[model samples]
Target: MNIVDRIWNSSLGKKYLMALTGGALFVFLIGHLVGNLQVFGPPELINGYAHFLKSKPLLLWGARLGLLACVALHIASAVTLAQLNAAARPQPYATPGAYGASKASQYMLPTGIVIASFIVYHLAHFTALLPGVNGVGDFSKLTTTLHGETVPDVYAMMVLGLQVKWVCAFYLVAQALLFMHLSHGLAAMFQSLGFRDHVWWPRIECFAKAASIALLIGYSIIPVAICLKLVGSDYVERKKYDLKAANPQPAPAFVAAQGKEAK
Candidate 1:
């Protein structure tokens, strides 16, 4: 067998793959949160940013495809390793001890599955612009002016989509699950990759918890802001002004008639 195939079939190789993919995803979450936080800025700022991304279709779709591949590899390796472990231990534990596994560790699989499912729904709601699912009507038609140019009103879409109480609630719940999954996954990833020295273990664990909490807070801000009415209705009104500013109407007919008579 080739070296690649041999490594992939080994237990250590599966753990390494999971660690690498999870680390990549963790970084992506941080970057994505920072970008989403721009919604708190002026309509132009976020809309312009969205326009910039759309202008680069190659980079955008490349990143999307890469992320999808990483997700598939991560999930496949996880499932394969899990099945292998289960098959190796066909008998139940006599003492019922969890073998020092934390609650977060024990529930990683289910939480990961929930987060995966949430990702699909999220893409459909925002990226795909699904009607009724995102609670926003004709999101593609929503436009805002940025530096005299009309662009997709991403800020308005975020506000309208999360303003629905149920959607906000669902996001909050999914974030909580994501936190639970990350809290364990981050530390476990390091250990799996052979960074489990006793001297640094506690520090790594602390960092994992801190990172997980940061992610939770960052992701929760949008929904919380919408729920408090801090972003929804007001943004919609602002968007109307932006659209008007981008495409000004002609002068009134009375003014035009007076000018014609004067000439």
Candidate 2:
């Protein structure tokens, strides 16, 4: 057998690769979402943030290589595991309803594959992957740049795309599928990477589900809001600071409670 076939045939090697790459991608997703969240503020805000990320050419290249490695490992492990799983089963269903499936069971792999495709498309559309797409914005031309850098208005693309009936519908389906993928993937990855104790398993599962949903909702909001034009440039600019207040004044109830307790 070829070296490639021999390595994939080993159970331990496959699982180890999957666990490592999966963990890397999970952390990257969280970081990516945090960076992307800046887009909700203003074009300048996110633009500058994006610029900062790409400022050092070497660092950007390093990040790209790391991401490419993660993607390669993820897909390789997924395909290998899928084949192994099929081989283990080896029997076709005699009847369509012969086996019952839970929502997570039915959707995880399919949704994960779909989300992977979405990520590829997103990178192509927004990043400097394709030719003729300038990197970020024309920062030099700006009168008052936020951070002396510029990021493309990725939000505008999302808004315009989702504004179309068909595209919006597509994203809704993809987003739902993505949530299912995350629900399973996040839990599975943590356990695979040795977070497997009974005591922590349930709580980790809960945390995974909550974090996945929160990220999904946070991303979904920008598109929905933009499509509706409920959030414009002015609102984004104003909300930047408004959204970051850590300890604003207490509510009336809290103030009244303090007053009465003190009295």
Clashing residue pairs in candidate 2 are: 47-150, 47-151
lDDT (C-alpha, whole model) for all candidates? 0.83, 0.63
lDDT for 242 in candidate 2 is 35
Report the C-alpha lDDT of model 1 over 1-263, residue by residue, as the tens digit.
99889879899988899999999999999988988989888877777888988999999999899899999999999899889978998888888778788889998888988899999889988998765476535455466677787677898888877887888998999999999999999999999999989899999999999999999999998899977888657768665554345334433344346435754
Give the poorly placed runs of model 2, Cα more than 4 Å off: 1-9, 93-101, 128-165, 233-263
- Tens digits of per-residue lDDT, candidate 2, 1-263, equal 99766766787667667778877877787787787677667656665666677678898899789988988988888887887877987777776742665577566668778878877756664553341122222211122245453344444443333444554555666777877877877787777667779899999889879977987887677556665666554443433333224214444355446545743
Model 2: how far is 110 from its true place, Å? Answer: 1.1
User: What TM-score would every model get versus the actual structure?
Assistant: 0.86, 0.71
The alpha-carbon deviation from the true structure for residue 167 of candidate 2, after best TM-score superposition, in angstroms, is 3.9
lDDT (C-alpha) at residue 168 in model 2 = 51
